[model samples]
Target: MTQLHYDVVIIGAGAAGMVCAIQAGYRGLNVLLLDHAPKPGAKIRISGGGKCNFTNRRVEPKHFICANPHFVKSALARYQPEAFIEWVERHNIAYEERDNGQLFTLEGAGQIVAMLRTELDWAGVELQLNCDVVAVIKQHETWSISTSQGQLTSAKLVVATGGLSYPKLRASDFGMKLAKQYGLEVIPSRPGLVPLQMPARQRAWWSDLSGLSLEVAVTAQRGPRFEGAMLITHQGLSGPCILQVSNYWQPGEPISLNLLPDVKNVAEWLLDLKQNAQSLSGALKQHWPKRLVQAWQTKFEFDDHLANYTQLRLDQLGTSLTAWSIYPDDTAGYAKAEVSLGGVSTDEVSSKTFETHKVSGLYFIGEVLDVTGHLGGFNFQWAWASAHACAQDL
Candidate 1:
């Protein structure tokens, strides 16, 4: 195998690795970008339904969660949404702003990947695709990366293998494994941004509710909560709300959904229509889809008649609507996940640089590290931020 030398050798040519390579090359370091994929940015190609929600305008440190909590500020502060926007403007990529300041390409996700490739090319970074790295070792201050075809040496080793979100996109646990090999702490990895399944009995009761969606606040007890649309699928609950909460969810806990949050006077509203006595199902039908009303009627004993029902029945129904408890079967697992949560532990690396404190010249970036962002382009922002952090120090 050919032996090549570089000032920096980056593994995984995804968002983080590519960005790191560009920054490192700008510093006049001989940079080599490696990935097992035939091309770069497969995740970028499929992200945000192909338009690519690149970043959010409103990004605070609170939008992220990590064991250390404060490890992301430095990198995120260095290359924030504005900087990325400037880069987009530089490339003249047409984009449109969506809800909550999410930026998407008017052209396509491919343009974003092209722009990244263009930056790497301009900075004189060597791009090596389809190179499966077998192992990495540190001798003195340099890290030697061994691949199927050749050996490369560098003073800096970046594990940008990302997470096992899209296994078809070449996701691997290599990053986490590498951290462990070097005696760095690693968080247990699991699926995120995925749907949850239902128990057999629960599925039967809510089976008719499949394909139904409604705006709600879904919160797992003692975990992250989200307010958005909840969708009932063949498996269980999905949609933005469920996906967001799954990142912080633990097993054996029930989710509480506020069906009518911020809505007051439900009892009074029914009372106002006392002139027309409607069945409990018929009254709810006026507000929700006919199918949804039917499903609820089948599951719960509701009092529809405002004048005929006792005060106790009315009060109970109002409370039930406010807090609907539903225990899901399980998450859709890794297949449908957008990203993987839990990775190389934050304690293992320097927050400022993402390099191992115990093992010098070894860096971890993007989803490979234990940092995860909320849905809506925060993950991509993380990819850019963490990469920029280590590249500056590299």
Candidate 2:
């Protein structure tokens, strides 16, 4: 057996691991970044349909979900979107801002990965790909890692294995397991930014409306609301609005959707329609697709003219339109999830340095640390911020 030594050894060469390696290497430290996957940044390559939403123009603590709400503030404040944007600018990567300030590469997601790889090379960071980690041990404040390639030792170890979402990409719970092996608290993981699955009985109805899209305001029970484009899918519901609300959605919880988000008062609008003696289907057709109106009529059986409905019935119909609540059978699951909801508890690690308080030199960063971000590039910002914070301390 041969032994190699480094000042820092980072597991998982995804977004956080690469950035941390580059930052630490620039400090003149011997840093080795290892990944079991043959290629680095597999997730990055597929993100945003290969365009890669790298960061958002506006990043705030509120954009992240953590057990400790304040855990994200320190790192996010230290490394804002502007810092990453500046780096992107330096690389001369062609990028464009999309809806809600999402910054994405114009060429492809490969540009971001290539830029990170370039940075790693420039910083003198050693990258080991297709290396399977066998075991890890700590002695005398030094970490020893046994891998298929060889035995390596380092003073510092960073777990940036990320969360389990894309299993086809070989995503695993290695980080969560490693944290538990060290007696660190681990949060229960769940699929996030995923589509909602309708119950078997309701699926047929929703499936009929598949491919139909509309802007809607949606919220899970006791959760924050989101307004975006919602697409009816063959499986159930999807699109920006459904994916956004899915972060807070739990099983058996009802999701409320304002079908007519632009309408200030549904009851008032219905009354005005009543004044015009409009049929319910005819009124809805003005704002919705003909198929959607037909489906709604079939589901609710309320296609009568307004003249037949009394004031109270009109108000009731208004409520139904404004607050249509539906219970989802489940999420689309990890296979279809954009990210995992939870991992190593933030309480077990230092918010500033991302190092475990109980075990020195053992740190966790990125999605592996029970921190999730909302849609539209917030997650990538967290990866950059958390990695930078950990590297600064290392």
Candidate 3:
């Protein structure tokens, strides 16, 4: 078996790991980054439909979900979105800002990966791909890692293995497992930024409305309200709105969706329609897809004209339109999840340096920590911020 050593070794070659390696190497540390995959940045290559939402113009600690909400503030404050924007600019990477301050590459996601690789090369960081780690053991002050390639040691170790989302990308629970091995607490993990599945009873009806999408304001029972486009799928609900709420959705909890998101007052509009005695079908057609309107006609059996609806019925319809409660069967799970919620408990690590409180020379960053960000570029920003913070200490 071959043996090697480095001043700092980072596991996972994805966003956080790569950025951490670059920062540490630039600090003149002998850095080695390892990944089990054949290529680095598989997640980055596929993010934002290959365009790569790398950061957001407006980033706040509020965008993240963690057991300790305040834990992310330090790192995120130290390395803001403008810092990454500056870094991208230095690399001559062209990017554009979309709705809600999401910043994506104007070219392609591959450009971001290529730029990171180039920076890694310039920083003199050794990147070893297709290297699977079997075990990690700490002896004295050194971390001894056993891998498929060989045994290696490092004075400092960074576990940026991320969370258990995107299993096809070789994402694993190795970081959490390592934390357990070192006596650190790990929060139970669940799928985040994923779509919700409808109940079996509603599946047939929802399936009929598949491919239909509409703007909506959706709120989970305990989560914040998000205004975005909601898509009806064969199984259930998706798109930006549903994905945003999925982070806070719990089993058996109902989600309230405002179907008429643009309408200032649905009751007033319905009353006006009543006065005009307009056909309900025609009024609904203006807002919904033809098929969806047809489905509603079949399910709700609306009166031919608004004049027929009693005052009480109109009040009920207004409430239904404003807050339609839906109970989801479950989430799409890790396979369809963009990220995972829950991880190494933030209380066990330093928010400034991302190093473990229980174990010296050990650190956890990115999604592997308890921090999970909202959709868009917030997760990537967390990755960059946490990595930069960890690298500075290394």
User: Which pairs, if any, clash in model 3?
Assistant: none
**Which pairs of residues have clashing backbones in candidate 2?**
none
TM-score of 3: 0.98
Candidate 3 residues lying further than 4 Å off, grouped into runs, are 1-3
Work out the TM-score per prediction: 0.94, 0.98, 0.98
**Global fold similarity of model 1 (TM-score):** 0.94
Q: How many residue pairs clash per model?
A: 4, 0, 0
User: Tens-digit lDDT track for model 1 on 1-394?
Assistant: 2237888888999999999999999999999998999999999988989999999998877878788788888888888899999999999999999887889999899999999999999999999888999988888877878897687788778889998887878888888888888788888988988898889877866667788888777787866668888888877888988899887677777788877644567667556556467566766665567888766765686645667767787677776776677777578888899988889988888888988888878889998988888888899999998999899899
Deviation from native of the Cα of residue 160 in model 2, angstroms: 0.1
Model 2's alpha-carbon lDDT is 0.92
